[model samples]
Target: MALATVRFDAGQPVDLEDSLLGGQAHRWKRASHPELVEGEWYSGVLRGVLVLIRQHGQAIEFLSSSSDPQAMIPRIRDHLRLDDDLKAIQAEIAGDPNVAAQVERYPGLRVLRQDPWECLIAYICSANSNIETIHRNMERLSDEFGEPLTLPNPQGEGTGTITRNAFPKPVDLAEAGEAELRRLKLGFRAPYVHQAAIAVAERRLDLAHLVAAPYQEAKAELMALKGIGDKIADCIALMSLEKMEAFPIDVWVRRALADWYFPGQKTPTNRILLEWAQRYFGRYAGYANQYLFHGRRLRDRKPAQPESG
Candidate 1:
């Protein structure tokens, strides 16, 4: 297998851990923990390529299973959104007091530019689900239908080969009936997944055209899909289609807004919250959403301090 690698100085726009696990994408897995670096091995497949990445002090490194290793750099850069000026975006998002606190709390968090087709399906699984459920369902989809790929182990852990399934193409997934998908525990979303896969496989859902379209237009196109709603559309818009202004609101974001921004007012409608986010966070709302989301996850994971005695 062909092998390639890339590295970047630490504190760059990309934080592999935060960028992957920060609620934007759930398909990535923590492959191992090694002593050489102050980081862990992460493995993921995107657009038929398997990427194994890990970060150490002042440097992030990657190994890819693509034929042309260097060709993967552009994709990786785009995936991590390294081209964006994150420092500036952070300042812009910090306009909100709550998100400002998040900015100070989580410095390396970033929004990733994910593969659009996979991103859409992943978010479909996100509805009414926690991150753990999203991860399990997406993994099941890949394991059952997506192509299998093996990556070279730079760290030389187990057998020197790490295997994973690349996310299936629309055409492949289209062949899966909703009933079969339901068996994979997609539940009520089975039909929606089936329909979406069929639409893309049949060329009815043109993600390329949608990506080139205005943000709202692209959003409308995604919302036209079976299971996609305002939140899912914005998720795809921001992460996959390169619409930086898109802000997806989940219960966590809603709670944050209620507690921090709109105290005393009734819980705002989804439309109102979205409109308010657009106005408040402006063009980099996606980045702001990520920082806030990651911060919320961190807060939730924190162990409670002992009660004062």
Candidate 2:
């Protein structure tokens, strides 16, 4: 096994637990029970663990423990589009004095660069569900369907251990019946997951096009999938497809804007909110919105319900 360490500068705000990927780990936890080996980093929440993460070509052993993640991984290497993405977002948000103020509050809120396939299914599972539930479902799905990896336990003799290899691919999930998934406690989302997996597996939905397609065109295409609606589509775009301009508007964002920006009024309709985000926040609309989401959620410290797109 290979190991490495990195540290964050003093006063540099970074969350290793939530840093490398999106801070939300329900999907990651669902995907694998990666061993958590803890050590001090910036604010002291770094872990050394083994997980199957793709690196350019094949799934390789990753010793994912962070110190100062901001200074460790070249930001550009962490995100394939770091330059254009940061530039676009910074410029777009600069137009809005209020949004700019919010961005200034959290210098670390960057849109995550995740594998496209993982992003798609994760967000699909996200529809009308809370993060905790999402995490459980992801874990259960992997335990049931994903490939598994086993390694020797450091403190034991021949008493080895096992963890799922990775998130199950669309084909893996598609092969499952609703009854089987229901047993895992997916509830009403079972069929949706089953069918979505089949669609992607069958090449009915060509997700590869998302890599270079215009954001709107890509979003419209994602929306064509049954379980994927506007919000989920945008999530796939922003988090998965690398569309920095994609803004996923959910109830929290709507309420946040209404409470902070609009005040005492009904949250703007989805269409109106979308327009406002694009017009006001511009190219980095997705990045700005993520900061707003993260900051607002942390401040309120309440779980917001997911709404239909």
Candidate 3:
């Protein structure tokens, strides 16, 4: 790796593993399966931005600006803002004694912050799918439509190609037919993807504003899209737009919540989970749900706990 310094102004705190791995951008190409250890630094692309992330064991380092890294360090140290308000969210979810116990068991878990555009399309593909399949489909989409970037081998081996740009703009996808996407093996998501791209390209839909809009309005607008349902709508609002109050209920969260609150009971429906989350977790409900989701998926069977105050 070249000796270059990078700077990052973390408008909000970032969790590399949770943010990158918990969703569609999981299958990163490396020269070798480098043994990731604490404080280990590696360079890769996240959401088309070149970043140098350090595995601090507990948390990851994110460099958003690739200018003088040494000079950027002090600025980032001074500018980075942790969302400690999540503690209040944790308390709200923890109001239920059992949920509190689970939260206590997995303290280091946090909500992932991803690029809004990528999160928008990625979660749209997430409907009725598994992580592994989502990863495969995302890779295929990149191979088919995403811009190409050459990457160096982390192990000092030969270079390789990985999707290096944002998911194609909606116009780009609108140029292709459903058959082309189907060829990428998107399965039933092909038409959905095509129409979404068309929607964005034709100015029929607006995705960026959802981030700043009120949660309810954002959810309503997202749901108005052809393929989006309630769950996917909430996902766009929460993950893409950074609406912390938006609670997205997927099968895993439903299972976790059911196990915690109604053991031996049938899995709760998405509607019920959403209502419960809004009532119990309040504004930070989305943050708490994210932590719980990552804890369950990435860290084996453990529940997410909060860091000590």
Candidate 4:
């Protein structure tokens, strides 16, 4: 079967590299196929559909598995948050000089609206783990339990097919149990993922309801689950629950707050910093957090210049 293509006009600048692979979502891979060059095309599974997308100037081009590619546009839009006014959001969080620099440095980075259950489990695996580890764990979980899918290679005739796995559902994970999850190298998070999956699968936790709940309420609900702390809860709220005011304070973000906002002062607690961030950035604190966190990490990775002779 041939894949359907659609060009979506986002009406704003979008950097697919920074937005999709910049740490918000872990499933996307830079396409290695000859027809889809690295950094030009990305392949990922979204809500069970295998999607290959590329940024075409201001518009986005997509090749998806859906029979009705037109109907999937709405979902694609929501996933990428194309309707968000990037300029307005940047202006809102640009009050701080450091944050302003990040906005200027990395344009078109938007928080993805992800599936609640998937986001929850992903973050649970994120505790004390780096991005690479998280990606490995999620991939392992999906490969083991997720539904298998095959798509005609983008090259078409005689090029064979590509295979991908949909992210596993809560019922799938719950049935696998913690023992099976441990084999995936989830480590300490194995039980937590298992328990959270069981809760969602059993309907003991209503992730869908939290999407409409207030930020605090949503954070509280997520924190009540095993292995979810303030930071992870805030991540779920900001990325999935539509809580832009939720500021997650990871080590990088905490360093940003200390080095930029609270310079020369005693470092405050995560709770205190979160309060100040929400008050300072108001409804767009989460956006500010992402920019600062990503910007700081990138800055630190750069090699220092030699001292003047």
Best by lDDT: 4
Listing every candidate in turn, what is its Cα RMSD in Å to the true structure after a full C-alpha superposition? 4.7, 6.7, 6.1, 4.4
Displacement of residue 128 (Cα, Å) in model 4 is 0.8
Clash pairs for candidate 4 = none
Where does candidate 1 clash, by residue pair? 10-58
lDDT over C-alpha atoms for residue 269 of model 1: 89
Per-model TM values vs. the true structure: 0.90, 0.75, 0.76, 0.94
lDDT of 4 by residue, 122-145 (tens): 889888777777878899999999
- Candidate 4 clashes: the total is 0
Reference-based TM-score, model 1: 0.90
Give residue 35's error in model 3 in angstroms: 11
- Predicted model with the maximum TM-score: 4
List the global CA lDDT of all models: 0.79, 0.60, 0.60, 0.84
lDDT for 273 (candidate 4): 93
Ranking by TM-score: 4, 1, 3, 2
**What's the distance in Å from true for residue 82, model 1?**
0.5
Positional deviation of residue 189's Cα in model 2 after best superposition, in angstroms: 1.4
lDDT tens string, model 1, 1-309? 234368765446556777787667888878763532224678788789988877775376887778787787778777777777888888877877888888787777888888889998988888777777788899999999988887665555553576789888888778989889999999988888889999999999998898889999999989998888998899889989989889888876776778777899898987899999888889888888777767765665433321100
